[model samples]
Target: MSLGDERESSGGYGGTGQTRTRLPDTDPDSYGTQRRGPRSSSRGLVTVVGVVVLLIAAIAFANRGDGDPADDPTTNKPEAAATAPTGKQPVDAKAAGIPTGYAHDRQGAQSAATNYGIALGSADMYDLEKRHAIVNTVYAPDVATAQLPDFDQAYSGESFLEKLGLDKNGAAPSGQTFVSRVIPVGTKVTSYSDSDATVALWYTSLFGLSGESSRNPVTESWYTTTYRLKWVGGDWKVVDFTQKEGPVPVGRDQRASTAEDMTKAVEEYGGFTYAR
Candidate 1:
């Protein structure tokens, strides 16, 4: 989400003036030197009164839902009706750095999808031990065991790391910054039930290397990753997930930062713990 990124003080106040003639305390048509007749003054007063009354009505209407959320739409709705979590709490516990033990509901399914997306696409995925931990913690137990061998080969194979400008050990070469990160834009619950739910997270992933000498430069790509969540052992776990290209928007013509700057930015920026 990082694209990569004053006050005026008044000198002096004018002194109060004392050169105007004071209007008479009582005069028939002398409210001011320009003079307004009583009838005109009354009309003016009525207009002012009307505006004040309207303002009061508007203020009251705006605050009508302030007292009780259950009694009003503006106070209770939007947040409740929206796809965002509906009063359900995100997991307070973590399993091997991944959030787990989600509530067995629609909100929990969406939350699990978001956190799983991050874990699956994180830079840590490049490391064997951490990657295995993530898959185990986020995936259904049986599936994690099954995917382990292939998962290791996919990330640890010589050609795989070489293609991404990384060593066989998954470390970037000297003077290069490795970037593998996914930023979840939002989540959508396409389907839900007591036992199962399907959620999709639309996200942008940054991958490749930040080195002028490297062939693969860090870049962003958009995809929607759908997760089929199962309510396993009182928590939502990913049974399977898939990614498809875009819902991509047209690229904005912005200045491209130098590789050095991009490296610095990625190094300094920390990833977010997202909840939907």
Candidate 2:
């Protein structure tokens, strides 16, 4: 879903569909930071794959401080995770099949925030009733009640869905494919404590419709979703979260794909449960 122009002007769903209008050039806000430009140059997806590598390095530097790896202007040194295996493994099973029960450590907190980013940024957030289940599943039980009403407005807000070419229920019309997905690229620990931690999950999101005749055709947008996480009942849960624009690279102009082809690609490519 490439909503570059439209989203920039209208302020598309920034981090779970709040009433977002625009992003500052590069300062922190209530949600996210600045706005992301379109990925029109060359093959955007391929470029996205490459950007993830740099983001991994950026996360390492942020955690370890503006240290050795990034200090030298010429040294193309690798970050800790890129240099060697961290020995951590993905959780095999899920709580309600959602990859829960994270370790009570720094790495574990990072892992939990990454996975929850995927869950919250998912298409499930669009489905009115289904959205509730996702909130209850990943968000702490205490704040979830207060959060639901705001979510209801964002996801089911009357003309908002219409603008994206979705039906009242957030579905694409028959024969059209609606895509709302988040692909996590990196993670960083902003702050951490035994019971509380702040982490940011960097990722790309796909939103809009995939159909030959669609108006709001599928678009790609970059985002960094920051989460205020809490260790609860032996797992990390989102106490609060925010979304901001990007550090997107300049895109190289390229031929656009056909609607049918875009739809096919989206269908064939499955989403993965991201881990740190």
Candidate 3:
């Protein structure tokens, strides 16, 4: 829906009535980043498409944060079938230290699917070195070796960087810091088995193009990204993935923050291990 189509609607089964809001869908292409005279330009014309791309960047960066991905207790346990030897029950852990625990069976697969989704959509993918670290961390050893180079080529290409309005290595243009971040709102297990699973992640992504003369400026989007996961090398690793537009709600009518504030928030506030 277009941003101009935003409306408030409320009414439900419980009769308590719930109002649903939606973000305005601005044009993704027209805006160039040029703050007018130090005052933030209020061009409410960013597209819903841009938001999804930024979500990928956000998740990628957060995945590279401190601590070990393997050590996450939430997704690290063995399946109940393996533990029980009978292969009938499932295993699950909701431990605090874990990224987000899962049951040894389908639950574990679903959990893996969700966490992997976060990793895949993160910002670390922009940096070759960090991108390698993330691919290695999340994928099976063989898969990492074989797929890392491909991912490297795909994300590191000059054209790809330019498309996002970045330099050869994906650096933001002068005076502008790129903000591509994904915040997973929630996840759902669509299908699963003992060794595989498919999960749908509902998320909000932000992509910024904040400097003067920027070809690509900052924007936000909401969408659903799904990951098909497999149990590999004793952990859940992504095998395939895809993205789609959302059942996105309308955005707030609050005043937009300045470019500087947006930049600071991106730098200062880190992402989280999403749950529920």
Candidate 4:
């Protein structure tokens, strides 16, 4: 889904005038083991594109919330009470999993959006198997069934996977780790209703092709991606989403971290259950 085709610039990190690697040659057996129908794969590709766009929206929203002239009103408020309620918490999580299982209330919708935002931007999504699981888990049930096959096709494409420095099923080389991680900074409910809600998910993403022969090495970018969700099938499922440039702060000249440090930080830093 994230083609990494072109380099664009704005906010904290400037584009380095480089694009990620290209996909590799196709093997006929690549899709032989796939369990999806052609129509299903088409729907899955749409879901992947939608998720990618939503991720960009979350980054822009986070960077915007970080202190921008245009975002003064939203920023001026005292930050939401950091502590969540003690009982019947609207939030929910599976043991040791990314906090995605949310309730159906306004807070629940916001929480779902935020959590799904993390899952969408995670490094795991780059892998073929993991990407399939993520799409099935994060999207509404019906949407997942209709979309998973296509997502599988898109990511499994020889050229596309090659671009990300991955093999079929999106796996990186033995000694190399493919990095596509999202770090959620916070979340805010821009608007809400009983059945529909718009939530702003703020976070940063780590995306690039990383390996010895990699064209695009690991690099980090800040952004905020927002989603419009609908309470469907007893959970909050994304109905639609959009993205914009950013509320990114001026660039800082902090010394860049080493590739190893960046990789370690990604592995060590876990995402959060964001709330307004």
Cα deviation of 127, candidate 1, in Å: 0.8
User: For each candidate, what TM-score against the reference?
Assistant: 0.67, 0.70, 0.60, 0.62
User: How do these models rank on lDDT, best leading?
Assistant: 2, 1, 4, 3
lDDT for 217 in candidate 1 is 68
User: How well is each residue in 146-178 modelled by candidate 1, as lDDT tens digits?
Assistant: 767756755676765665667887899998887
Quote the positional error of residue 190 for candidate 4 in Å. Answer: 3.8
Encode model 4's per-residue lDDT on 1-276: one tens digit a residue. Answer: 133332122111102122122112222322212112234333322222334444443434444545557655555657657675652354555522556556767668767887777776666766666776777666666666765664555455677567666777677777656777666676778898878888887665566544444444665455666777777766677655544434545433344455466557667876566654
Residue 249, candidate 2: alpha-carbon lDDT: 50
The root-mean-square deviation over C-alpha atoms between each candidate and the true structure, in angstroms, is 26.1, 14.0, 18.6, 18.5
Question: Deviation in angstroms for 198 in model 1?
Answer: 0.8
Q: Give the best candidate by TM-score.
A: 2
Error of 2 at 220 (Å): 1.2
lDDT of 4 at 144: 65
TM-score result, candidate 1: 0.67
**lDDT of each prediction vs. the true structure?**
0.67, 0.67, 0.57, 0.57
Choose the strongest candidate by lDDT. 2
> What tens digits encode model 3's per-residue C-alpha lDDT throughout 1-276?
101112223121111223232332323444422212233357554444334444443422334447787656545656655443432232243222235334456656655655655565566667787777766666556666766655665567676566566788878877878766777777788887768777887877776565544444556677786666777656566665555677677554445566667777788998765433
